[model samples]
Target chain A: MIEDKNQQRTNLSELGEFGLIKHLTKNFEINQPSTFKGIGDDAAVLDFKDKKAVISTDLLIEGVHFDLAYMPLKHLGYKSVVVNLSDIYAMNAKPTQITVSVAVSNRFPLEALEELFDGITLAAKEYTIDVIGGDTTSSQKGLIISITAIGEAEESELVYRNGAKSNDLLVVTGDIGSAYMGLQVLEREKQVFQVNPNNQPDLDAYTYIIERQLKPEARKDIRTLLHALEVKPTSMIDISDGLSSEIIHICKQSEVGCNLYEDKLPLDPQLINVCEEFNIDSTTVAINGGEDYELLFTISMDDYDKIKGNPNFTVIGHMTPESEGIHLVTRANTKIPLKARGWNALNG
Target chain B: MIEDKNQQRTNLSELGEFGLIKHLTKNFEINQPSTFKGIGDDAAVLDFKDKKAVISTDLLIEGVHFDLAYMPLKHLGYKSVVVNLSDIYAMNAKPTQITVSVAVSNRFPLEALEELFDGITLAAKEYTIDVIGGDTTSSQKGLIISITAIGEAEESELVYRNGAKSNDLLVVTGDIGSAYMGLQVLEREKQVFQVNPNNQPDLDAYTYIIERQLKPEARKDIRTLLHALEVKPTSMIDISDGLSSEIIHICKQSEVGCNLYEDKLPLDPQLINVCEEFNIDSTTVAINGGEDYELLFTISMDDYDKIKGNPNFTVIGHMTPESEGIHLVTRANTKIPLKARGWNALNG
Candidate 1:
């Protein structure tokens, strides 16, 4: 079925690296004051009043982490940076700098590289983060992008997975499953096109979903909003692997349990429509869909009033006693134990 | 000729990633005191009392940058790290930590990845550097490694390529051309193996030469040696892309020029022997061979006697006025201009 879309494949060389980076990261916003210089110079610079910093790096390779046949390098670059930034945000730190390392084959002309760089530079500009330094080299085939992101926060502001309390409230920003639906739609269209080259993809209806798959932004705004409200998350993490998987991480690490209501799951009408079209259970998708770069946190009951009515956030669940275990109450009034079907690359 | 060795090719799967990393960096040494951690952490933690930290990264891929059918992975990993570390060292700072990202295809079993990481971890331990964070991803094909090394030294102690002064003495650490000879020997053996797979490689005579190629270490000690003797290099760099190319960097950045005497060029007897056997000019190899991870620096005249008889160093020549240009004196007294024949991947 994938063959149906073979004709739709476009050569990446058409877009230069710089142009691609620019196209992809056009909407990003920088919310951290510590983000001194981002994206253009040889390296991004960050000045910190705090003493400690956390840095992490990741590499995504074509065919392995992605299929360029499906991925646009511009969007790929944006998603890649967002993925790493999620880790920094999860640690309650403000991201300030990033370094990108890319390896391409000679099969690709200079234009393809510039496209990749275009996305990088755009992300740098929008995130107000610097592209401090990176490695550029030749690959035997396909392409590899390695990114390192650095973040800083005061020692007091940093939140760890172990900080969740038994009675704290659990919340997630934005609606979930949209990004996952986006991927499903893209994959379906890809397969559809393979069978018939002239078949135009009915992409207009799936625009939002496809965009979610192609572009995911780090929730830098949540940090600022929470700070302005004078509330700090007892435990925080970005929904990367999936809500269930991340909830389990916090519960396991904090030795607490939680109870979430399926009906309370935030839903974007478009996400629901796509799930209906794809014959996927919306509840399941919302719970288990990964790559939703949204913030998930537990707040003290006293701070609830400050955030409860905010349109940008949803109170998806609340913490339960350890003995209650992490359970989900379905709309049919059935209580089921929560489980993880999160993306675990190593195990797979 | 490259195809002839195909029959004898050792599948990378045999070694695994961890095993390979161990094999390559088994002998590197850590000589700087400022290194807080060297290899084995989320991120290399650094403590520079009063310095502007400098970091640089470089990536190397198989088939494109290196012909692994002849180039060993151990050497590849070692050389890859050296190239990046050399950049940090070139800034006249002490390297303290490094992050390594690798992308490999499934054709390689897990063992091959272990081999690569083994060498990387060993290199970290030897250099007293901590292995911070890195990404391990699957690639479409071949192997790719991107390394980012972080280093720091006092602001006054830091040296840049642009700091070279007119009349400063040019100094080099260790001998050169051996690594190039090593490459020549390996290529020749690869050719021989292609003609006959069963014919064992007679490498007894090329032990030192091959070691130079497969296991070149960054000259971490040079910084300390100079400091201990109360001598600071006005400008410094590690010899990676060959002597001529490096001199050009110093000249262009420092806005100065110099004369290099061919007679004063340091070549070990083993290097001389191989040059004669291969019928390649030894001096040419020294100037253009590349992959010699030694330090080249400029020092003041008053410090000459301090390092004159040190076995680990060589006083090659002196820097002259800008108009003198970069000239290399021949053994027979002919003065000719030096050209940059160092590695340029764009052209390659």
Candidate 2:
């Protein structure tokens, strides 16, 4: 990815570990008032008076989670931060700080790492979060990234997956299956270009799906929107795994089953067209596709009046008693048991 | 490493991601009072009313940080947790929670992971910290572990490396250089085993140093001891990258010079014996050897009388004006400039 003819290609060893971290993080400025100290210390210090601190972590490996041939290092950096922040947002908390740890082999140039940090800096600035502390080390093979996101919220405002009860209405934000369709389009393009290196395939029509895959954003606005509408979710989770898998988690944890409707799944028109072109089922894509980064929650029926007709939300179904099983009601009125066909890294 | 002849070898795929995490973390219990929720949730939640939160992170890569040929999985897990907690303790804070994220290749069976978790659980129980949140995914090459430790302390009690002033006495807790000598013993034995597979390493004499290398304990008692003595340190850092490197860090950050005495460095008697047997310089081993996990701090001269005769504390150096520059005074009274020969992963 470091193809700049006019730029210098410096090796990482010249800077050393401390010098490299200082060089890359020099531009990051602390913006959060809760952050007492950021970087340049054994640890970062924060003060969240009277509020509970929420912490989440994620690990992303190169060949397993991504392919460098098509996935740019900058986008990978941005998405890594986005994925961790999605977990904090899923708790209905405001993300305040993040720590990023990256391990890279000697194959990567200093400029490549700079590009990756550029994307990370952009995400931190856009999200108004502080880059607190991190560790940089060498890897024997490919790149490995780990991010820990810290947030804060009042104890009473926090939501958990076990809070969902029977008769709660299931709701989801934004559209599904776009990211999966986007991956399909990218894979096809990759195969096409592999056979002929000189080929430049036209991909103007797959713009939406491709962006959904590479530049997915965490739902940072959902918590504010719900608060503004005076509606509180009984339980919530981010759709990192497919809709069916997350629904099953909420159901099993809360001791309640749910009836998910097939017709109510929100899908972008571009995704539907791509699914048809690829000869894939749209329903299957929506249920099993991962990395959407959307929010899925259950709200009590009393708050249904407040959320009804909201463009940001779609009421997919209602929860059932523990005696009933989780089922999907098809457009043809046929009932089928829901299955967790989400992506599994180990299984693959 | 998993050689259970009576038990069936279960592949990681059969449990999937969620099921694997649930099964592995089922035994983890929240023992810290600051922890409100642990595992299961999107993010772990904690409450630290008026105390400032301290957070630190570290990454350990196979072949770069540890060699699996000689390192056991259980010791690796415990050392990983201890390394992060050392950073927290270096800040003069009480570590209360941690999040561990691991990426492993398919070669690792479910039973192997259980052994790793067993070590992590032991650390959590011993340190009285809660195992909060984490992510587990498949890697392409080797195992990688990332841990983030969270702690709390009063704002006034926190110490940074930049706070040292002239005339402060540099004190270190416990002995150093044993771990490095222990590593030399292990590497030698490994080579012997490779040449003759029937050779058994008699490690009776190297027990103390070998334990120090594989199972080093963080200086968790130093803070309590300092509090009891009413001696607040001006600046502090953990000795993970050798004593010379850590001293250089404190001197550079605090804008002061230091005079470290060679004869004052605390070393175990067994370390001296091993150094003589290997024909290596004892002072060089003590200065450049790493992974000691001892606390090196600077305290005011007024507290010297209180800590002078204590066996747990050693005055190895004293801070001087910035114009003097950092130097080491040998036993022969010769002054030489100090150099940081700490291990650099990138260089390797």
Best by TM-score: 2
Q: Model 2, residue A221: what's the lDDT?
A: 96
Per-residue lDDT, model 2, residue B73, is 81
Q: Total clashes, candidate 2?
A: 0
Fnat of model 1, as a fraction: 0.40
Task: Write candidate 1's Cα lDDT for B254-320 as tens digits.
Answer: 8899889888888988889888987777888888887888889899888889988898878888888
**A58 in model 1: Cα distance from truth in Å?**
1.4
lDDT of candidate 2 over B247-301, digit per residue (tens):
9999999999999999999999999999999988888888889999999999999
Runs in model 1 deviating more than 4 A are: A1-50, A320-326, A333-337, A342-348, B1-51, B66-82, B342-348
**lDDT for position B138 in model 2:** 95
**Global lDDT of model 2:** 0.90
Per-candidate Cα lDDT values, in order, are 0.72, 0.90
Q: Give the C-alpha lDDT of model 1.
A: 0.72
